[model samples]
Target: MISVLFAILTALSNGAASVLQRRAALAVPDTQTMRLSLIGHLLRQKVWLAGIGLVIVAAVCQAVALATGPISVVQPIFVIELPATLLLAGFVMRVRVPRGVWYGVAAVTVGLALGMASAAPGGGSTSVHGAVWVPALIVTGIFEAALITGAMSTRGNPRAALLGLAAACGYSLTAALMKDAMGRLDDGGVTALMTSWQLYATAAAGVGALFLLQNALQAGTLVAVQPMLTLGDALISILYGVTLFGEELRTGWWLLPELVALFLIALGCIELARSPLASGHAAPPRRSTRVT
Candidate 1:
């Protein structure tokens, strides 16, 4: 329950940050994208700075949630971030909420509820078993490398999908590492937690994921990036929870509802991503030299 609460807080904070960041991104020139100059352009805007603050808050909340609960329980909650982002965007833009967006929100909310109830995910170790880290890191590295390679060979939506998948993998890896790092606190102390290699690895993985996500967003439409990101993170996190942390979930008959729920969530994410407000395209593209 502690995990669930913090996870919700993290999702809401991240959703709010995304809306602020999108507004800032929309106000900037397209030429600045995928470049270091983009950060400089954004820093001039108060909205973007506020967004960065919220991002830090979300990261702290996420760390708390991962430390206290099973990864399966914590990660799936983030599926709501997309719907929340769009809703916040609509409000910020002073645009009326579209009927389709309402429907998508309902679908995602219901699907997430139904899925969590059906799966009843729980009972995972806080830390991975001994000697498992080596193989896990090796496989994850190879997988990310392959995705990045594929992304380089493609353009547009294809590239976005590949990069999104890679980002998903990175985020999942971060969560696993974070949990392991936090587990050290129980075993030793704060010093042990700070000294753990998992602590440093978690930061590295998070930065890598953020970088891939930025490129993915810039590569193509949100429709291509959002679904892969939404679903991929949930699925990959579940895999990590089960394989690395020994988390358990209902199987056999329960699989039916879980699959159905994932489909609904995916549909909702696609619909939400298609909205102009959600894509930060509702406002006309205006590149102003002065930001005030």
Candidate 2:
């Protein structure tokens, strides 16, 4: 129960932080590629640096939440930021969110809640099957490379979808690794992320995920990009739990809710497909906000 509470808090913070990052991104002048690179270049303007800093902070909060919670509880809530972000954009940023988008958000939210509620009840645990980190890192790297190559070759919104897929996979891997590392700890709440190969792998995965997501954002609208990323992350994390961690679905009849979740996910994706066309009218005009 405490874990779930922390997870929900983390999810809300993550959502707000993402909206801040997006707002900061909107204020920058460079093209998406250049903006991405420039974010790392401290010599540039404060907004770029601030955006990067805020994203890093948000990520840290997410990691802390995962350290304290079950992946089943944490991952689903983390995924909520996808739809919540769009809603925030609508209300806070003054972006015009579509009615379909709200419906999709509700469906995705309900589906995720149902899915989480249906996760097999247990105290959190993590175990690595083989080498602590080397193999997972290598495989995730290869996967990220393939995803990037595909994203580069693909056209338009499909490329965005592919990138979202890649980002979600990366995030799922990162979460799994983080949970595993956290389980290895005994005393201090903080594990030295540097000492843990799992953490390094997670960091590498995060780099690729962030870059891929940025590219996706460039290719599509915020409403579209965010929801697809969220859904993909949830799906991949669920697979990891079942296939990798040996977590079970709640009932003998688990297939039904799984199917329902898929249906809602598909409907959400359809709504997202129309988002790029809607962006010109959806994005809010630039407003001044301090980045502290």
Model 1 scores what on Cα lDDT? Answer: 0.91
**What tens digits encode model 2's per-residue C-alpha lDDT throughout 203-223?**
776777787788888876555
**Please, what are the lDDT tens digits per residue for candidate 1 over residues 1-292?**
8999999999999999988988898889989978999999999999999999999999999989999999999999999998898889888877778899998999899999989999999997999879989988899999999999999999999999999989998898898899899999898889989999999999999999999999999898889998899889998999999999999999999999999999999999989988877766676435579778
TM-score on alpha carbons, each prediction:
0.90, 0.74
RMSD of 1: 4.1
lDDT of 2 at 37: 63
Error of 1 at 11 (Å): 0.5
- In order, the Cα lDDT scores of the candidates are 0.91, 0.65
Model 2 — which ten-residue stretch has the worst lDDT?
Answer: 272-281
Tell me the deviation in Å of residue 29 in model 1: 6.6
Residue 229, model 2: lDDT of 74
